[model samples]
Target: MSTLNIRKITPTFGAEITGIDLNQPLTPEQEADIVSAIAEYGVCVYPNTGLTDQTHIWFSRMFGNLWTIGGQGTRLSRFDYPHLFEAGNLTPEGGISTDEMARKRRAGDRLWHTDSSFTKERTTYSLLLAHEVPAEGGETGFADMRGAYGALPQAMKDRIEHLEAEHSYLYSRSLAGFPVTEEEVENGMIARHKLVHTHPGSGRKSLYIASHALRITGMAKEEGRALIKELLDFGTQPQFTFNHYWKPGDLVIWDNFCTMHRGGEYDDIHHRRDMRRTTVMAYPPPPVVMDPRFKDRFDPAQFEAMVDA
Candidate 1:
């Protein structure tokens, strides 16, 4: 079994792990060590690691089933391997806004978010490899949600612990000017998640809120809006974030359950940057039932009500 050399960055955010070739299969012992390191550090950065599409997909499978987004293309051809999903520049010229790449550009350029926050079953882990990087800008930034929670005022933390927030792809896409179809909105593909979620394997508490979070349940509309704004602002402070400037051959794996990430702007018009990402579906959280009274409050039926007020 290969041993991992792990170095933690901050009390809450990142770690640099070495001593394993991602190209080869890991023994059960190596897998456990890697998983344990991830639990201890919300993000792990492996430098000088060259990973091919096959190797990347194989590494992703070691965790659990991969997450496939609705409209995004699958990682490899379905005939090859069906579970992984591809992310980043997919255009021929390696440009960001070719007609062929517009949808991905828009989705990725939007604010910080956990992968698939809109889905009922959220993603657990995300593995991304830098294939090409811009000479300037386009750094990926991550915030330690666990650290964000720990830094919150005691009263604020206490107030939101049991509160739940409604997360909807429809809501987030609307903010970014990409509205979802009516069919998707009806399927509960959009879900309500607790404001704070406990990590299943590590027992660490993390702030589960994000930029895409639409509203809080059981709270007045104005109040919920204000609270969401406050929490977002607090949780994304500089002290809680680590910005990664990429170099090719770098594979980063992060715990999506305890961290949030955003894409920083680059000179998309002048330079080219491309990265590939594979996400793992999370082990489901406990069940959450919508209150009958509030069901219509945020649903299509209340669109007019929301507009009227």
Candidate 2:
């Protein structure tokens, strides 16, 4: 592998990486260099990848294992790619969803959030490629959480240093006026993560505010929400942010731990903005124990009954 040419997209956060193609196999050294680039810069953009779905997935696997959305498969109706998820204006039926609820659900992506924050297996990195970019507006905005944490006042930083927040998909969905069933709330999808993430590889601290972060644990609901809003505002200031305008065959990879990204607004009804994403899981899910102590929980009959109920 030769020296990787990297240019700063923004002074604080994003980098444009050249001299690599996803369609071809990357050498071990090249792969490591890309990972190093991600650790150093929260987000990196590779222009003109022209990668097939298989090659796009292969490139993603070089970084880590793929993370799939629980109980959901590929959203592209025409495409049978299993390793990626649609992050675009198109519906599962290959048409735009005209339904209000579906539109509201998709509207939640415009909020600043990190992927898979609501799951137990944290999303390590998110790689998105644009195959069909809209003509007008389909940009993705990313904010630097590390720079956000660094800019916070000492008192503010001290206050949230040890705090934890409850992240829930239903919580963010409700914020956009999307309906949720009582059963869905009962079987809630939620996870707890530190308010400030200590980035493992980079050895940097980043404020972990997300739209999915419903509330701070042990704090009053209203107060916790206020805190989240405050942190999000501080973390997304212009100085610590970069917005990527989409182009066909462009790939953008971001470390979810140190950045918050959101989909940009576009004419959903007229324009087609087809984007696919491959998320690298932080680690695989923990193994299920089949000990007698956990017998009742693992019992198939009991699980079937619960599902029926």
Candidate 3:
């Protein structure tokens, strides 16, 4: 493997990595270097990789287990791969979907979030490959959570150091006015995670807040939401974010542990923005630690019923 060409996109976080063939198998050294790059920079963009869907999924597997869409084989109509998320506006007939549910779900992607945070088995890295891009306004914005944590006042950091938050996929989609369906609730879309997470490989601490994070455990809902909002507003300041404008053949990968991302607006009704994502699961799946307070909202029986039904 040749030495990778890495150019910084931002002073602090994102980088463009070159000199690797996505069509071929990655050497162990190359793989390790990519992992280390993600640990250090959070986002790596490989411009014009010309990766096919098969190659994209293959490359993602080199990192870890791929997250199956929706914890089941659930997928959008006309999309072939169950392991890949169809993160686009196009429907089976290649036009923008008219389905209200699909449009509402897509709208929810505008919120800053860490991938799969609502699942007990959260994701580690997400590799998104662009197949089709609109002529304008479909950039994806990413915020540096590690930098956010570093910039927080000492008192603020100390306050949230040991705190935990309840994350709910249902709740987040609801915020976009998408009512939760029974299947989503039964899919175990709620989980609890620490407010501050220390990356094992990088030894860096990052704020773990996301749009999926509904409330802080043991705190009143209104107060917890206020604090969460305050943190999100501060963390997503211009200094901490980079918006990636997509081009066809671009493959961008980012570590979910240290970043929050949201989809930027495009004329979804008139143009197409076809992006597919393969999510690599965090190894040894994070334990499901439930807060009794949220049990009413996230019942174990619902999941059991889902399994039974």
RMSD to true structure for each model, in Å: 10.3, 6.9, 6.9
Q: Candidate 1's residue-wise lDDT over 1-309, tens digit each?
A: 438987777655798888899989898899998888888788999988888766786787777756543334432332133343445544534445455335633554457788777766678889988888889887888888888888889999899999998887666665565656645655645678899989775897889877668778989977997998888788888889888889998899998889888888776656767677888766531243544432321233222332244
Q: 1 or 3, which is superior by TM-score?
A: 3
Estimate candidate 1's alpha-carbon lDDT, on a 0 to 1 scale: 0.73
Name the Cα RMSD for model 2: 6.9
> For residues 95-130, could you state the per-residue lDDT of candidate 2 as single tens digits?
766667667888889899999899766788999999
TM match of model 2 to true structure: 0.88
Question: Can you tell me which runs of candidate 2 are displaced by over 4 Å?
Answer: 73-77, 181-187, 284-309
Give one digit per residue, the lDDT tens place, for model 3 in 10-71: 89899999988888877788888888888889999999999986778778877776765543
**Separate clash counts for every candidate:** 0, 0, 0
Best prediction by TM-score? 2
Report lDDT (Cα) of residue 100, candidate 3. Answer: 82
TM-score of 1: 0.81
- What TM-score does each of the candidates earn? 0.81, 0.88, 0.87
lDDT head-to-head 2 vs 3, winner:
3
Worst 10 residues of 2 by lDDT: 294-303
lDDT of each: 0.73, 0.81, 0.83
